[model samples]
Target: MHGRQQPAGHRFRRSLTAAAAAGALLLTAAPALAGDGGGRGGGAGGGWVDRQLSRMSLEEKVGQLFVTYAYGETADTTDPDDVARNRQWLGVDNGREAVEEYHLGGVVYFAWSDNLREPRQVAGLSNGLQEAALDGDGARVPLLISTDQEHGVVSRLGPPATQFPGNMALGASGRAADARKAARIAGRELRAVGVNQNYAPVADVNVNPANPVIGVRSFSGDPHLAAELTAAQVEGYQSGRAGVAATAKHFPGHGDTDVDSHTDLPVIHHTLEEWREIDAPPFREAVRADVGAIMTAHIQFPELDPTGAPATLSEPIMTGLLREELGYDGVVVTDSLSMAGVRETYPDAEVPVRALRAGVDLLLMPPDLPTAYDAVLDAVTTGELTEERIDRSVRRVLELKHDQGIVARPFADVDEVAERVGPPRHLTAAQRISDRTTTLVKNDDGLLPLADDGGSVLVTGWGASTTARLAERIDARAGSATAHWAGGDPTPEAVDRAVAAAEGHDAVVVTTSGAATAPGQARLVRALLATGKPVVTVAVGRPYDIAHYPQATTHLATYSYGAVALESATRVLFGEVAPRGTLPVMIPTADDPGEPLYPFGHGLGYRR
Candidate 1:
């Protein structure tokens, strides 16, 4: 999703279109000479843009720069007996009073909302909130509706919207086309519900395996691959044909921290030069791609801002580094202010003002809306934050809306959005990509493609049900298959149960969930391997997990347990898909001998 602005590629395309349109118009009528005294037409256009800005009260303009979470009022007041009470917990509550009273610029919808099952429902809810944002006055601009629909684990639109593998899966697939396809699918879904902005295509490269929040969300550990995927996602989201803008997120980089910013502030110890070389490449590539917005991470880079303030409140990080050094003229939005990283550090009201002073256009989800609004308004009155800064941000925000066609065409038919979102064609595309992307990491002792006649099979792990589904599909193709399932700690007992069940069968399949770092998984895999049965271990997560089961007769790294990835694993196990996917990262060895368990781009072909 384009952060704070439209995608760069989309902007370029629009510019080209505008240029062509102007040229065609010039052909019909003689073009006026440059500097031929400001013509009536030019004056009228300038006056219109200026009048729109000038007519806005100081409050409205400042409001336009503040985006807060919309948890519906009805949600909070819903009776415990109400059927929709559970749905209310998903972050859609009536913040209409805040929007109307404060002239809030926009509202972000969280995936947890109960009202988002279908596109039409989403459309209705969006329209209602947007209408409320206008407050029955034609003066206030329509609200900017946004969501984080990055697919897989981050999807907001459920059911009808097909979910693709997360970025880590895309990285494992080693196909930029797959990333582009996922972006296109995601874009279609977002636009279907009147959601114009997506905080997605996480640009963070998961260089640190211990990164808690950005693990599977990141595309790859390789900066170059992450850049390529980021560009692809940006292109796909703003293909403009889909009418949605994608934002490349968690800027400067969120993939190296062990801390989750949602819970605590993370510190980046890198120097400016190191960051420029390693951490900043994907963001720069996104900026070069002209991403509409950049979402600032809550990380504190003491080297850049020694005060230990999060990037959201650091002028050097936001303006000096992002705007001046990187030359990103697009909108710069802060990540949720509700996150502990910022909330715990700064005073309630001071956070938003500090962010505005740091050149942040959008203050996202401040804990208290009225407090933030009053604080920013007071800052402007006190000359702490100039009205000029407010104007700058408002203009960019307006321009984005205009560019995304949100201003000109405020509402779209709910049916149309429904039709476009998760269409059969897009789902088919996701399935095809998943089928081709599932990787087979190891097949020693030729244990894969188990005989159809193989009697009973044992399936156990964190995501065993998903893995079992794939195994069932493969088993169907092979022969009549019986499978037993067990969840949690693949322990000696767990493996023993599976082994006992598979005693009369030809092979046993053990699936491990979570990352490879979980201790119980390793013990279970070793126990299963010791059973002397043909062990096929499928890692429905990161390739690093496979280090735990090096002795397994066969190993597959599906990268994720998403529905699509599971289906892809089925195809690979059945020798249907080519299993062309490779390891996108170096899987470390258990012995800590320093040699990688599996090298990048390592995959085994059936024939080989």
Candidate 2:
């Protein structure tokens, strides 16, 4: 209903009989439809896409627009656990059964869903899923396997995958090169596991200090800095060698909101003029960089659409602004339909139909695939959505698959996955990125670089794992160390134990995550400051903790609690590495809301 309607009979739907036979030889004999220009009429692969489109049933074409989630390591797993999970989530015995039953176009992997366990296992799972998809009864197209390998806190595959401090760390480092290198390593590792699409490089500009979800995930508070880093990341992810499709996500920006869209819809009250100045720059830069995909946010901009619909179901935002005004002909995907943000306005079945009608090419993680898929098919049959409209979306998807080399070579060698993923060199690069992001915001007391003289240090913080890791790293450099995992918003007994423990150590390093909201962390830091020993505050989550702890003179912001980041913070503390990162977001003064405790770009060097 929203896109330019083509004539009803542009490409008549044919039966699946001949198409199934052609699909059998698709891997070996099909024409290589690999190249750029994924717009309608299909850039370089136009001829191949048109021929394939002519032979597809309407049901198969509709299935290509969905990218659903499933649970399994392999498609044909006989394991009871795998079968139970597959049955619970997809009403199938295994992933192969799900693919055939739903006629699925793609599948997304999540660690909790048991889709990703290790590099080799993930590669095998990907190959198995592809086999099921390309079978005669299935959709007979290469699946676009995707995952949220955003590193930092959002990482799915653990251990063997190289970990780096996330986007805000890169923003604090203030180097586009670091952003590119981080993304390049991530892309290579993801592609090695047969994930062709990465839903990452969150392009939101975090201007509001109180933002809940997009806090450390966003690159920077400054628009220009965010734009620069976003474009670099896009290029890095889509580098010819990696060939993974990079998605610039949460379009029209999810930065300024105080609400999390996962729980409910967030309304952003920026006018069109304000949107252009604030939120549009990063997306514009991403588009200019030729990003492979752009994901719509679930938030609403009343100024952009007076109808008050969120971007995912609004034609003015997705089609008019993104397509016509911005000239982005690339794929436009919706944020997960399973989220509450997109579900509040419509029924489960209608969400996908509305999203497609609003010009969305891919519907991600619909809560019920059968209901959503059948609703889409029914829309076409009822003339609510024409087949021509469906063709346009399917063409874009196929074109993207062709351009990203997924159609031609969709499998990864299980033997090579281990060699390619998380090698020593990639981990070293990740550590380097982390080292540069350790920002020395306040060193007024000059208690840092504590002589490296075998003095005992106390490392206390939120999560037990992070605190223990920091203690180990510091102990290796310093003489001895003690670790106390004072849980988030520590209790009085916990804080008392930590403060009593700090008395025995020469100096204390207290890491606070989300200290702005967690007053107990501020209480713990203040109590440690009362001990009269050198108390160094480390903000490992949001840098805004400094605003809450104006009295703590020796402070640092690592922007992440990731192992690599904790290691980098320890190195900075011991003068092994200089704290080179500047403040990407201004830490507002606690006393005066308008004033800054540490202004943007403020940091200290070790002077070594």
Candidate 3:
């Protein structure tokens, strides 16, 4: 309201000489593959977006930049404690309240948003929110409903949603084609549930095994391989039913940093040259592919910008590096502003404004919406932020909506929703993919394909949950597989008892995930191996577990613990499926050659 209305002859502009060149290089390096150009900007609804853009008030333009969380459900919170928690977590009662008050452009649903079990309920919830957005007091453009449907452990959607094998699993398979298929399934299932944007296909080239956050979330440590898979996943995602946008996130890369941006600001000290080699490939490929959106990382790139500001707030990084150097014309969204990485540095009201100044198209989950909205409004009035800048981002957002056809058909089919998820063929395909991705990284003792002549098998691990799951899977495949000492901390007595029990079985299968971070689990594995009972070890999560217990008779890695993955791994051991998975990452060992102990692209198959 404070800025002059309809500021004429204006286009959003910022200096980005380097970003433009790098983006050009990336585009030239690969063909410019992108949005179908089916939507508004260059698509059929171009005039519609322009018409809406022209009539929008300054406040309405700013509202489009904000996307807040749709916390808990609508069951009416009578308890004061429940009310307080809802307010703190979600910022409003439901999507409708946020939409009407802030004229929000979108809402992101988390697991707790609704106890969504049936896909019908999810679609209905999304439809109701869209209807609310349409009738709300704001700009009334259709809301962009989104969720984090990254496959594997990061999958936010619960059962029946076809949790495909994760990135590392795909990487291990060494099949870009399979990655595309996995993405198509993920995107399609998400769209069926009334979700449009998937903030996934993490392009981060995870270079550090100790990187607590991005491990296994990333495709691989090798930049080129990550880029190839990243491009493939993006291409597959946008092709899904109703067309969901795939975002290549944690820009510049969150791979090398050790800190979790969710809790603290992680720093990346790579020189610009090193960055081009280590971090920039995946994002560049994403840009060249014409991905619909690129989410900025919260990590600091002091070399890119000496300001010490996180990429979300650094104009040099967002505008100069990402926008210009990368030539990313698609929407540039900031990672959740609520994360401690930026929030600890910039408090409530100032974060959104700074992000806008830095050239962000979308401000995601600003911890405090009211305060952030008013601050951006105040910045416009004070001329610290210009109306034209707001306008450009709003148009991009609208163009994406126009492109996705959210404006025309925002609601998903409630009855068809659940039916669309996890088709029989998709489950079968998932099993097939999982089966091929089980890598046999080590077999010094060559104890795999444990004797199947009615021999008893004992599955033992530190935790009872996975131990039980593993044992049941093996039993289902082979006749005799039972837990030696299921699910508990690795007490010496417990390890002794499990070791004792392992001797009675024809073979022992030990599962381990926490070796890199937890020493106790490694001790348990070594103790089991020390029993000299032909123990076969499964590195359930990261493949790094084998380094701690390398003397195991046989070692394998599933790259994930998802049900399909675990089942595939057990099947491989029982000789139901031959292990075809390769090592997507190096597992460093003391006797490592020029390459790590088990170099990348190393996997064993059944004896020919």
Candidate 4:
């Protein structure tokens, strides 16, 4: 099942060259299955999967059902933090040892866990982990390495990996093509480092403005728009020869809840009809697009299942609805088993078993891997779960691996990583996509397209980095600028300084993030407005923030604070690109709950 080892540089060059040569052909060609099966029945690489399955022991099959996490960039690391995290989670000192001991079917990387560093280093880490999974004393199958490279705020892979303006920014653009292009670029870049799975294209329709977790991550408030973008991204992320598998997530929708599942379980009161209309469109479209996986949410939908089980543990929701009704044959993965939404209701040992029973093919980030693995093994031993049932999921897992080309081309080219990740072309595409998403919500005073008077400008915002970046961009594009980082909920002193500083500038630019909840941000905006300088408000975080300071005459929304997004906002501010994006979600009036400050689809474009 494993390929012979070669020098890292030599192997990477060969693999990358071959992949590049095949890239164009693979775009139009059907996904290559490992063997003669052609459609999910392939073996390790060239043989039959059934033959491999028949030879597998119960323990091995059990291992294939679990996708675990580990820390450290390499299999062997001396870093104290890496050792501590790996030992704490996997009962091992390094990722390689964990793979060998548990026979892990997959591994998910996270920035905080030190699994992702840079392109070349990440490629090396991926190659090392693959060696352990395929040649070590484990499942002897290629491991499905995954990460939440959702871009925007949820991205794990950073610089040199293209930064997208996130889902809401895509929503504001209202162009499915942009979504597809962004995802394709992200897919190719991720594949360069050998990460084959992307837990992204968040399928939730964020109808609730207060949704703490899914706000900017979601595509839009409208289900139909979300559906279109979801399918487009699925296709885009799985397009090229080096395409990584894309997972559409938070099934049954985590959009309407104000609660974060990591903190507590959120129960959705949507009746079955409401669920179908409001939340199911995106996942339905994802399945139609042949998405590699659909991740179940931890939130509960009582109307869908009266049993009160969260989607992660509910057979009625996962199997009955997602599997039977939706007719999705792809892998069904559970959200992190460690989340309070799933764990609060069940014991640590029972979470994985219940998730599997609920039709989850892969268990992600269980708090304790040893206990979870043992619980699943014990369940099979006690007949609580059948060996055949375990085999079913392993087959699905293996199928995804083969379909994604991981079985044949699991190793990334160390030499090619720098060239392939975040090249100029990808960066241009990212900036273009971000530019299209800048929404000019209001310009009552027509204060934009700052006069080239070489005037000084005041750029103050919540994030220190964001403010500095905006100021620098504006300075280069037009005039002298001073940046002040007004912390979120700015203190009175901070507001006073910004207001006093406004006297030196011809114009004041205020950026807010979640200002609806931060009274101090509103106060700062009002104080700057009272300064009598033309005030231009950029809602760099939430478009909903506009309602918090309704007195402001000019407003724009980038829907993200990503570097490219701020650049896009600056372009729009100076009229480099005409603002074309409209509101994807309504902006309610802060003073009156019933009226909207800005209606959905509302936007103002600069006059020709």
Candidate 5:
């Protein structure tokens, strides 16, 4: 939910490749001490952080609490995405300018910011920004570069790197260790690209089927399962080997909500007892495991704070509940203050000050950095905000940077990045995880394994790229197959064309996304059923994709459309790989709310 799309405009910078990356690493190697670990952030006295804090001015210390965004939307452009209203959301038109002009603490990247073709590009961008932030008499504290590399569909930098299966896929596989390994791989790769903080391993327990945002992002509906996996992921991401700070997110929880806070505020009506039982487990477990950071959610909890404020700006929730009750002293980051859920209400400069007053440590991507910064400064001048409070936040932020070793080694070697981004071992692990996550929900008439000798097969629906890949992969394993595509939510003519094209095919393999909310996809699936062929439908995104069309001969849910997940599903279709994944979530087909069509922990496999 952090990024909508990438900015397609080109940068005037040099194009970086693997070979060039080797030379860049060699060149950077000479400045290792100065760039990364040469100097002392804190001397042997251990009071170095106190010494650093003692010398800082009010303006510089206050600046340490705020982290704005740098979209890198081209070297010079207002908004490269071309969205009309996004013109105002644009901040830090120049990354270097933001550092010198604002004396900022950190920067969070979006897909548009990176627009990266390779890992070297990110390394170059990060190093350049760090140089600017550490300019003469600058903050001296290195920039805390962060991004939402949550894997799955929310990847900010996953193209040339390994794209592993997301949380739900790991949840379905029923292995906490696998979840940890996935996060470890993601962490190592992110660090290789010079990003230290990963806002991932969503600790939400998705108990609501109608949840629009966190369906596949959450681990499970059960609180126990969510806690176990969330702790494992945090441990993996924060492992000394990976060396990246992992953040547990959307505190208290974003699950069981019908509304998406990215657009509007969602109200949680659960009691404090319910919160203890359902939503608080994973966060507690994460804190117990010493997770690096915890992100606050925009959704309001009526029980937690009767003031009707979101957790991001609630003293009771952020300070009283999380800090005192849960005993979590790590960094508490807000989930993008730029989100409409909070921005629409506080469209003024007062947002940041109020958040600080509410006990938030790091204000992430304030709607307007200049306005927010000035507002906080004014609050201090008026005695509304205490210098002591500012000092606390600045100290915590600096401590985290020191803990991450960013104060010394702030630059990434492009050669090491290119080599370690997606190693062969990681690719194999991803494929294995994908193979194990292919959940077979149904096999009517024992359609379990397609006949290896079957004739021409028809693979279609949800677009040409999807059907073409599925058809090709199946054909390579079994026999020849042809494909048709509706491009999702098809119009009448497209549906009629699909029916007319399904004439001589022996079997129909239809893959559709958005089967839960979009009735058009369900209608398309029904139209394919009219052909009377063995319609083997695969739900590519949500598990509930099959609830709309239960008449299909087989139903499979892959939880994602990532390359590995798709390839693994193709293997299982032809029995080249056996289906081993259990359902991470329940699928509802009927109007009643009593029981789901297929319960959680339910999945079938082919013995042969």
Candidate 6:
């Protein structure tokens, strides 16, 4: 659920306020130095990263290549005090100590302080953590700060900050430009708060509607559409000219999986040819476009890597195919090693060692950093993992740092950074996409464009009656309309209310939020249809959910519940904007469930 812990109380607030002020002052005075010139000659300080790596012993070098998670004994807090306390407790306070003592290559920020609600708090937290990483003289490689900010469901930065729709919403909109805009906005926002890397632009194509975790996260079920949208997002995020690096992820693909990798390791049964035709296209596009990094998925593909290990720790997947065949020379990072896919399948230390041998340069979110570090060290010491292999990984890691400008300039002013991060233009872009992408699936009987005359109107379903945006649109259309929110499941009380309202109104409108298969939502649709009044059902989730209430007089699928999607749906309902969006995926019915419900490019327009 929630990640990390937070500090609480006035003391925490005061401390954070002070730290932010101090960090702001430091930023103003030191200002980030341009990579053009200054500091350390060709060998001494000039090539400090190289000099330091060369000096590190085999154990130290192995340690330098690891990026570990910081765990604590508490509910993930966002409070500033918890952040301060966790920093000390998790050994994050001495980043310099960890790096200098163990020769750690990088540290990933996972359990952050909860008090980081405002932009200033984020700046302060990053500044303080980075300060700690530089603690002991000049022995540490600059730590890489990362977060999973994949908009919709996987957003770390909350409130006051702009949040965009998930990938499925973008797919429904039928526009690649919107996807690119979303990425650019996300990139600038991330860079503003001192996050250098964003683990996003989910390249997975959700061909299976039953996919639980990645339903809305994926771009589209169609491989070509997914590739086109992914490429657009990559270009957009990198267009800001900020040093932020974007990672196209879960390669070779995680779309067709019905099982969640968090609990169990799911297998990809597609053959190499099937992969090349469907899954590999997006990854190849990303590789050709020169993405900064590629993250391996935790899914096991027996057809590809017969060892039964997930791709994250597979040499055949990471090295032979991605490196030799695809020619990707950028940094190769692993997914979190804590997932059951890695833990349940292999020995603790073996995952990291095998991952490295498989040509992975960075080990992310290991179960135990120190133990994992020692294991790699012991392997190198025993000549199990050659020094040459260590050098290869370290070199790639350092080169990435240099390219990202992290090695050249350690830090920047948080306030100035904030200015570049949340430009109003980005939010506007999100709003634009949300407005354009929402579609109207079907509207039979021409019952839409409710009579302008004021009358009792019943609005049911999740998005139509619950979401503030959709509710506002419906209320705006009818001067004095009464809305009864079904809340995903309509009870007898809800049904009675709907019937009561329908008794006084001309018609009833029921809307569904999320997908059709959402628990109890289908029952609400059946209940509304049972009322026997002229009923209009609108689907505000994916188009596939429309098959449930086929008996309804009117049915419309907007393919999304995002703000923009709601706006477009309202426009179609009010006869303002003609329904132009076509179905990108097939929606299956019970009788012909095996056949595509609404084939690709299915739409209905009101002809005046």
**Which lDDT values do the candidates have, in the order given?**
0.70, 0.82, 0.77, 0.83, 0.75, 0.66
For TM-score, candidate 2 versus 5, the one ahead is 2
Name the TM-score of candidate 1. Answer: 0.86
Q: Model 2, poorest ten-residue lDDT window? A: 1-10
lDDT of 4 by residue, 425-456 (tens): 99998999899899988788878777767889
TM-score of 2: 0.92
Q: Residue 507, candidate 2: how far off, in angstroms?
A: 0.7
TM per prediction: 0.86, 0.92, 0.90, 0.92, 0.88, 0.82
- Runs in model 2 lying further than 4 Å from the true structure: 1-41, 137-139, 591-593
User: For residue 282, what is the lDDT in candidate 2?
Assistant: 90
Summed backbone clashes in each candidate are: 23, 0, 10, 0, 3, 22
Off by over 4 Å in 3: 1-41, 74-84, 88-91, 484-489, 590-595
Model 5 lDDT per residue over 526-608, tens place: 98888777788888877877767877768888888788888988888878888889887666554743356777778888865
Writing each residue's lDDT as its tens digit, candidate 6 over 516-582 gives: 4554566666766676766777776555667766666677766556555566677777776666565
Q: Write the per-residue lDDT of candidate 3 for residues 1-608, one digit (tens) a residue.
A: 01112111111122335654454344334322221112224568778888998888887888888887754443332445545665776566555666766778888878765526467767777777788778734567988888788887788887787877799888888689898888888888888888889998899987776788888888887787889999999998888446688899889789888899999999986656567777888999998887878898998877676668888887777776677678777788888988999987777788888888777888998877778889999998998887776777887899888777688778888778756898888888888877878988777666777656777889888556777888888887666888765343476777777877887787788888768666667778888777667778888888778887777768889888789988888888878888888877766673442235666677777684
RMSD of each: 10.0, 11.3, 9.0, 11.7, 12.4, 13.2
Candidate 5: Cα lDDT at 396: 69
Candidate 1, 1-608: lDDT as tens digits: 00111112111111224433343333223332111211112222344446668889888898888886654323133434332432342222255555676677777876554446577777777777766765576356877788887766676776677788778788777688888878877877777777878888799877665677887788776777778889888888877645576788897788768899999999876556556655677888888877877898999876666667788887767766777667777777889988998887879899998887776788888877777888989998898877777787877777666666676655646768767777899889988877766777887777665555646565555664665676676566655455566555655676667656767666666777654456777777777677787777888766677776676768888777777887787677767667777666666686662355666567777774
**Please, what are the lDDT tens digits per residue for candidate 2 over residues 418-444?**
889999999999998888898988788
RMSD of 3: 9.0
